[model samples]
Target: MSEAALPSRPASSLATPLLILGAVLALAPFTSAAVALLGGAAIALVFGNPFQGQTRTWTHRLLPLAVVGLGAGMDLRTVARAGLHGIGITAMSLAVVILLGLWLARVLKVDRDAGLLIAVGTAICGGSAIAAVAPVMRARAHQVSVALATVFLLNAVALILFPPIGHYFHLGQSPFGLWAALAIHDTSSVVGAGLAYGKQALEVATTVKLARALWIVPVTMGIGMIHARNNKEVAADAPPVKKPWFIAGFLAMAALVTWVPALHGAGHLVALAANRALVLTLFLIGAGLSREAIRTVGIRPFLQGLILWLIVASLGLTLVKTGILTVG
Candidate 1:
């Protein structure tokens, strides 16, 4: 008989995963992902990681699906126009951050791997950037962990801090969204802060940040090329590079919403579902942040990440306020 026709499994067999899922769903309505993630992590910290095996499934499978689902709510043309308007400043911000981060890293006496990881994470998309370039740079496992911890801690802080700062300055939706997209380290934090400000800000922030994330490809590959040129040999232990293919899916869903006649009527529903999925994704992401992981983040790397992010945030806002960077 097929599994569908078979009897249900014993409750003991499904308990942990079910509990975790239930918690996520139960908390999804009232709280933002930022809060949900913290709550999930706090629960895990107290009770131990109940969903250890499933953490991989959430990060690799579910998170990308959620991001793609988000595209269904977006108007691709508007996202594209906003992307074009912001691309120049985005690229410039990345370049300045990386150069300045590396220099500051030297001044701070941090080593090469930590410096590069922090620089890329600041210049591009936080943990994802660190993960992407770590293997290419032949970074040690400890180095990767420390860098990730630094970024994750700062990401949580940014989610809390950026929204109020934006409001305090009385920023318009477009400007606040652009500032969040440019200044925040991770996609979740950017979107969370944007959502806190307003719906229009959320849309603009998500689009611009995802567009900035596309730099992962060139950034990692370029680092690989530079390493090979300087060392004259490729590391045998280097991990295979994976492209951010989900970005294409995100863009495709946006196009489908913009162009497909049959799907047009359901756009609102689709977008709503996507937002819920993103929140669920964030909750799972939070549960993955363990206490042990947080403890391992050294003071030096953390300081490096903190300084770099503050500079990016301050510089981007200054440009925005001065009318040097136009908001869409």
Candidate 2:
């Protein structure tokens, strides 16, 4: 069954190498961020779009594994610590990010949804949040993909610069978790920062990040309702996706740790592995974005992203210090 022996294959085959590259990249320190920042260099050197084609399509399957594994880290107790504050924390964080983002975009005179795309991308899970919101808001493919690249570029920058900044201030886990949850743009960088400091920190940091993730539900629902009323969206785009069952699985994973207690050892390890895998998924998404398309989004999108990012960074600490939010 040697592939070389088969009838000459199409030039369109890249499935094997991309997966292997993703796995290998996961092991490198801040690999996700490094790949994202430098992935373009690889792409340029190769003179091909590894970001596209059959290999890229298959990468989506690996995504669920990483997300579900992330669930293994969260638990009932983590949620309990934040309480109504969980929703408030996410709400407060999102509110600040969106408001500030809009202001920057207005100043820059960028497109509205494009600005919001930057807001969500920077505020939540970077591209994942932007992708989630894009359909709900009915943003154009150009704007949305551009937003993704904008977020990816900043993510790489954060990886290079934030860790040293976190160190410079002598931040510890509780504060560090808040800094990460609010400040860092994606779970990969947050986890990288949290883990580099210590595993215990990553556990708390991831939980905080998950609490932030809870914002996606209400945020999407609110945006969907508004768009539906506005008639801005095409009929085909807004079809309801029953909240994925994995959310239940995520909640269940968290509960198993809190209530069962017996699963802690195994659960902890699984969660840690999941955090690592999630990092790879982010880079994979980053790689899929085209270089020119990425640049078309431009420096303004990043400025908008940065505005939201800085607000979160500041307010995250304020809320944590003032006792508005607390963590395990």
Candidate 3:
């Protein structure tokens, strides 16, 4: 169904107010990350998101800041250790997910760009990966939207389901964090699930996910060069690669805390505040999931994403459980 078919009055009148309320609650100490996401989603589905554009813009801006801020509480040593430890698995998983995703897209007869975007998103860091690769592939707006919506929908599910599943299986904090980092789509969702699981999980997941996210640079550049080779005109007009600079910001913050022991207390406070901002970020992300976005996802793209995600998640879980993917 087209967006025009949806009722407009509630979106025009109530959406802003509901969105504001949800954002306020998300920042409040009483609400958890999952609750904030659910509340924002409920508001959007019921009233539609009048501020959908604004919400997306804010989410993009705030998430990085929150991630960097959380880095203040981390030890540089731990960050380095986690990143280094996960390198082998991260490389292997990215290769597997990308190849498997492309195969699925071709078999499913899904649009090539959309399928590739979904695969890249799942294989790397969800929306960030898609955002980087979309410009390289020169995907159409609708194709990008379909891929993003599929990933977004799955992110919400992973955030809610992962903690419970971790508990059911009695997964340890480090293992669960590693699993969440490898399995979940978005960094925000990975961090949210980690937070829900435990402190150690949050730390491990954030470090590993950010390390995984760095793959976007090489991957996007590779795709851009390939696309350029295939189409000279498109190559001439290809956009410059957008690096994930926030990762550097995060590392800087971690280094600052690690080198200057005097800032430890202050850094802890900053990290705590950043965690709250992350919850607020998730709420805004949820608010962007309007009915129209859901409608735009369609079925085939969603199926491809779902199948790819399941395969990755299952394999990651097995590897982590078997101690093959442990963070040393």
Candidate 4:
């Protein structure tokens, strides 16, 4: 009986080891921002591909959900601050990115839908934006995969280059933070850029990043409505999800943060966990892109990212410099 039970124990025992591995990878440096690259690399090398027959299993189903669990920390402070203004910003940014990028793509002879997807993703919250708007626009999976790749590459580049650029310009903490939040692709990128600078910069970057994230909802809704009117025929299966679940989760999390601030937990632990989740998630998304998608997207999306980065920087600087938004 003991011998027979020993065989069953192997499967049970694997969980501990996997968890330990995850923990170590997420903290290889013990105390540094590079831990993200470390952990993300470990996951990518180990369980990266869905077709590898690992993530397809019942056990691996929790991985995407774990990524979703990052939503639990959304908190209300982010929501209350965003409110009506956030809704407006989301509308404006999405409209701007979609209209401008799509027009450019058409002129360049690129796929209009793919171009629009890339622009929205770059301008808003990165992958989430692409993931949300892709359905309404009838984007191919590869298009999304490509859009993410383009944004992810730029994000990694921004993480490395933006800090020194910020320093060279002698941007103050608040101005630098806003610039990073606006220019960078996502929260993790913003945090990485901010941390590379200082504490005050980190706080400022996060505030602006969250502000940017609030734009996803209206943007998706707006895009969806436009699609409904414009597309004469769309597959019944297309635009599968009614709305972006993450946006809903994001909003709910913000509400929780405001109404149930008690649940935010201690500052250090929750903040640390949230930051870890943000970094790991972003890196994983970047690594998930297919090679074919990269070949297809070419320089159109990259050029769009560069253009948006410039716009975000100039706009963000003006907003801060002119006291459009208050930062302490």
- The TM-score leader among the candidates is 3
- Model 3 over residues 1-328: C-alpha lDDT tens digits? 3333444434757778888888988988878889988888988888888777688889989999999999998999988887787576678878888999999999999999889999999999999898889887887667778898999999999999999999988899999998999999899999999998999999999988998898999888888888888783443333345567889999999999999999999999999999999999999998888777788888999999999999999888898888887888
* Model 2 misplacement above 4 A: 1-22, 25-47, 51-59, 73-75, 86-90, 233-247, 282-286, 314-328
lDDT of 2: 0.63
lDDT of 3: 0.88
lDDT of 1 by residue, 1-328 (tens): 2112323322244446644664567346666766766766665565556565486466667667767877888889977887677566667767888998898888888877778898999888887788788877877666777787788888888887888888889888988888898888877778777877888888888898888898898889888888767674434443455566777998999999899968976876766776777676666666666666766676777888889888888988998777777656
- TM-score of every model versus the real structure: 0.87, 0.77, 0.94, 0.70
lDDT per residue for candidate 4 within 199-276, as digits (tens), equals 678766765666667677777778878888876476443435533354455455545555675766743455556556
Model 2 pairs whose backbones collide? 75-254
Model 4 RMSD in Å is 8.6
Sort by TM-score, best first: what order? 3, 1, 2, 4
What is the alpha-carbon RMSD of candidate 1 to the true structure? Answer: 7.0
- Residue 69, candidate 4: Cα error in Å is 8.1
Error of 4 at 39 (Å): 8.1
Which regions of candidate 1 deviate over 4 angstroms?
1-22, 230-240
Model 2, position 4, has a per-residue lDDT of: 16
Error of 2 at 175 (Å): 1.4
Q: What is the lDDT of residue 197 in candidate 3?
A: 91
Write the number of the candidate with greater TM-score, choosing between 2 and 4: 2
